[model samples]
Target: MKIVELKNISKRFGTILANDDITLSIEQNKIHCIIGENGAGKSTLMKILFGIYKQDQGEIYIRGERVNFRNSHDAINLKIGMLHQHFMLIEDFTILENVILGAELSKGYKLDFEKSRVTITELIRKYDLDLNPDELVYKLSISEKQKVELLKLLYRNSEILILDEPTAVLTPIELKGFFKILNNFKAEGKTIILITHKLNEVKEISDKVSVLRKGKLVYETDKEKIDISELSRLIIGDIEDIPVRNKIDNGQALFKDYITVKNLSLIENGIIKLNNLNFALKKHSVFGICGVEGNGQNELIEVLIGLNKKFKGEIYPEKLVPAIVPDDRTKKGMIGEMSISENYFLREKNLRFAFKNILKNIELKFIKRFDISVPYSGCKVKYLSGGNQQKAIVAREIMLNHNILIFSHPTRGVDLRARDIIHNEIISERNKGKAIILISSDLDELLSLSDELAIIYKGTFLKVFLFSELKEKLESDRTSLLENIGELMMGVVK
Candidate 1:
């Protein structure tokens, strides 16, 4: 059955036509994927369906009946639920409380917690979801929180579930588990709509795929007809292979030991965040930490940047000037209310003159170099798009002449064009002999950028793989190094 259908949907934001007469149909009980570059209107179209945005022109049909959703509640009542990329759970709430929120069970005048707990337990068992009802949201890991979100939809009796980048934070082993859960959903005749940029995942889980480019549905095909390369080409047009730069021949060492961490162990909320971690960074090379999010990646970055001092670690180069781009940029990387120039100044302490005056000329030069699309240096960071905000951060961080750069998910939430620009910028920094620690969940990125990749799992570096040895292992072992790395990331021993 065709559960949802959109006909000639068009939406415009000022001069930008976000969606241009796009048409799509989603079937019942199938994993339908929507793939696109960032800002390609995937989010906009989903928003229109969820009643977050009003379409200028188009008709949406649910179950062959034309309907207009005024708000998310209407869509929810129609058995539709959406899981955004960013979690929407209250940190203070318990797992059961977060799941049953807004749709609480009430008896006469009071809320019925007992009844809800019993019902939630039954649902969790039925879905094979493992979660402690009394556990606080703040205590759960990223993957656990994601499972909670899934349970939220199931609790609502949502027949059609829309997940945006569901596996972006998951490790390889966790992803396998996730796929198993998805298969269970499919078996139970539940419809799923997945929006993601990971091409291999689309191939693994989706039955049908749709490609959106510049807000239009440009390609639709079955999984059997599509491959990763083809999908990549469709989304970003033709692109050449990413060439690995030759090792620089500069014998002059900018710094013998750029950064070092010893015996670093962070204990947060009674959890061993990172355990006895030790690493040394050298200039002119990128040290890539390949792991699933929540596997001490955040803690490692925090300890290095002097943000979280609640750790048993000796951090050398403690006072060395460093620029860091956090994984969750909206939360830790950039200040929304501040202007781009202010962010620039924050990154480079000397951007302001001794008189405490902003140097407009110097800021503009950095912005242009980083290709930040801002109307003016004084424009508020929040006003810029996600890609532009990232660009601004990169611009500021690189221009500061910081000896070490810590980039977490550098190209996250960025469009293809902007992602390319960011990649080039990372390359430029490497060429300049700046020591970098690149932490990312994107496997392809890790393979492409890192000379050495280490998988961090449950507060420890489980395994390290040299990129040069990956091909030989793949040929001899008859298994994927990436998959093995993913398994290690999820604490699965192979």
Candidate 2:
């Protein structure tokens, strides 16, 4: 039976028709997956359903009855809950406090703390969730925070749940655990609406799939009838392969020993996050670090970029300037409220060229070179699309007069066109004799760009492989290589 249905839904925002004549139905107790590229109107439709945005025209039916939601509160009361891509939990509060914040039980004008705590503890044990009720939200890991959000919805007795990009930050093991929880929810007669751009995930867990393209419902099918290649075509409108860069040899090692990091160790929350990690980057060489997410990738990046100062490490070439494009752009990379031109100035250096400051001309040249796609240089970075914003950041970082570059998940959340531009930029920098450290969760990206690869797990370096030998080595020892790397990432072996 269809638990939710939308007919002739239309929404407009100024010059953009965010959603045009879209219609869809979601079955009860089934996983409905929505797949689309960025700016494809997927978020708008989901926002309307969650009552965060009102549809300019359309009719919505919930369980065979027509209904309209004025706000998120109304939707929640009607048993609908949404877990956003960015979690919304207070960092200072404990897990139980965050879960029962807005909806608290009271008795005779007094807060019933004991009753709520008992109920929350019972729910945690019932669901087999490994979480401490008294643990502060700030102390929990990303996966743990996600589980807290889920518990919030369950605590409210929500019948229908909407998860947006739920597994983007989870490790492979955590992902498996999450899928098990989702299956349990379905078995208990709860409906799920999953919004994602990952095609492999859709094929794995979805029962029904819907594809949205350019603000319209382009196609819909059951899981049995869809494949990854077909979904890619529908979403991107083409199946062109990305261009691979030709390998080039660096002559005479222009600064062979550019930067060296020795005995790097970082401690956070009374735990050793990075322990005696050591590596060297050669001039004009790409050093790739590939591992499961959250296995010290973030901490390593933080220490390198000077964000985490509480670390013991001998950083050679400390006086040499470096540019970095961080993984979480929204949090660390760009100033959202600043204009494109203003942001470009963040990395500008004063050059004594004929006693004149020529930073303005340099900024203009970069703006044009990167094809930032903004109306004008004065446009705020926050108003630009995700891809354009990313381009602006890349332009700013690469244009800086630096000898070393650090890129962390440089192509994440970027579309195909933007990704190509980024790859080309990386190659251009490499050819210019700049040492680079590339850290990413995408193994495909690591293999394509790295001259040498290293696997880091639990704040320790497991092994390093040279690209020249990878092909021959993999042919002879595929099982051992994959198993050792996998086991190290999971902390099964050192």
Candidate 3:
């Protein structure tokens, strides 16, 4: 039986038709996966279902009964829960307190802490979450915080769980465990709605799959009939090959070192954040750095970008212009309140007179070139979807036209099509004799683009693999190569 149904749904945002007469259904006790490109209206349709947005035209039914939702509370009352890409939790509160915050157990006009703790502890044990309820939320890891979000929904007796890119923050090692947790939910007869960009994950966990493209439901299939290539084609309406790193003649001989660091080290609060790092970034090359996040990636980027000058290092050419696309777009890359045109020329040294027109023209050019879907050049960037926001930041940074480009997790929350576009642009820049630093948690991205790959762990480079060497190993022993990289990332190998 269908647990929830949406029929003839349509939504619009000003001039953009976010959802165009779409209809979809969710069956009971099955893991349903939704796939789509950025701004393809997948989120919009889901938001309408979750009561965050009311459709301009449509009818919703839950278990054969018609319903109208005025806000998220209405959806919650119907036992529906959504986990967004960014986590929602109060850092200062304990896990138990955060979980039972809005819906606390009451006894005789007083909160019943003991009863809530017992119930929460039982839930944790049943789900194998392995989280201590009394632990403070501020000290939790990324995965732990996500588990807390899940606990919140479970505590409220949510039967239909909607997760948006929940696995994006997890490492390859953590992903397997997280998927197992999802399987646990499914085994317990819960209906799960997963919105993700990774096709491999969809193939692995979904019982049924649906595709949305340009605000329309274009395709649907069962797990037994799913084809990844066909799904990709449907999402983007065209098939494109994975990006291949361009080959340079005579390797490092044809390129000059744009920046070199020797004996680079950083110590903070008596903890060594970076240790004796020595590397030279050469023009026309991509030096890839891959590690489990929080293991010196931030420290290394900070030192290189001159954000932290307290580090011990020898940097050549003391003055350098570096174009950086930071991992956190909201916090570091762009101002949420500013218009696209304003953020585009945010770093300009001179915008005294007639600069508005110049900025507007620049924004228009990039909007056309990058295919950014914004209502207008003056739209606040925060209003754009995650992928479009990323595109805007990338466009602005690339238009800076600097010789040194630093892209940190550039394609974190974007779709496959956007990923391809960004990857191609990175390669194009490298071919133009621009030195690039590619820092990412995605091993596939690193392997696809890097001329040389470094595995950093515990504030040190455990190993650096040359492209030629990795390619030979990949051609001969692909499994062993991945195993080696995985072990290196976890600090299991010296």
The model with the greatest TM-score is: 3
Cα lDDT of model 2 by residue, 347-399, tens digit: 57553352113444654676667645553445667756555677778788888
**Per-residue lDDT over 275-354 for candidate 1, one digit per residue giving the tens place of the 0 to 100 score:** 88877787777788987677788888777777787889788878755788877766777788987667766666554452
Task: Give the per-residue Cα lDDT of candidate 2 at 132.
Answer: 91
Q: Judged by lDDT, which candidate is best?
A: 3
TM-score of each: 0.86, 0.86, 0.92
Model 1 stretches with alpha carbons more than 4 Å out? 105-109, 238-255, 268-270, 337-342, 353-396, 413-421, 463-487, 490-494
In candidate 3, stretches whose alpha carbon ends up further than 4 angstroms from where it belongs are 105-115, 134-138, 238-245, 317-320, 350-356
lDDT of 3 by residue, 372-434 (tens): 888656788887887889888888888788899999888887888778778888988888888
Better of 1 and 3 by lDDT: 3
Model 3: lowest-lDDT 10 consecutive positions: 103-112
lDDT against the true structure, per candidate, is 0.79, 0.78, 0.86
